[model samples]
Target: MQHYQVKSVDTKHFRLTQADTEIGELEYDSWFSFTAEIMLADRTRYAIQPKGFWGTTIEIKD
Candidate 1:
């Protein structure tokens, strides 16, 4: 298994790191809606948002 670390930059921003290198970034779209955009180190982009009931699930799109 591989492990990734999440470091919080602020209330709405976070960094995903492996070892000491950053692999991706997550930034919230809004406070009310749990939506975000993810940008990878390789320049790949994705959209992430809460889905299903009570926001228990999340959906990721490339």
Candidate 2:
């Protein structure tokens, strides 16, 4: 199974890592809203945005 680890980069930024390798970053617009920028192992970059309150779901497109 593959698991992701999230660590605090500061008050507004967080880092996402898997197997000790950096996979992406989650940056908050405030204390609430955020955008996630992720890079796959294939080097494909994706930008994910939250659609609702508390980020109930994420929006991603190809």
Candidate 3:
């Protein structure tokens, strides 16, 4: 099985890291509709779904 790490997501691009290198990136915002998003006080307890589909995974680089 192959795993992917989701680094950053914004209005521009979604950065992915793998094997200590940038593996892939995607520029899109059409698959999900989410709102009421608030800034996390502690950015250490939340994991999000990456933009990848079909049995893909994402992780943080902290």
- Total backbone clashes of candidate 3, pairs 3 or more residues apart or in separate chains: 0
Error of 2 at 57 (Å): 4.7
2 versus 3: better lDDT goes to: 2
lDDT of 1: 0.91
Tens digits of per-residue lDDT, candidate 3, 1-62, equal 77767665766446667676765564443445321122232433233344456425544322
**Pairs of residues clashing in candidate 3:** none
Q: TM-score order of candidates, best first? A: 1, 2, 3
For each candidate, the alpha-carbon lDDT, in order, equals 0.91, 0.73, 0.46
**Cα lDDT tens digits for candidate 1, 1-62:** 88899999988899999988999999998666689999999999999989998996899998
Candidate 3 matches the true fold with a TM-score of 0.35
Instruction: Write the number of the candidate with greater TM-score, choosing between 2 and 3.
Output: 2
Better of 1 and 3 by lDDT: 1
Give the best candidate by lDDT: 1
User: What is the clash count of model 2?
Assistant: 0
Q: Give candidate 3's root-mean-square deviation (CA, Å).
A: 13.7
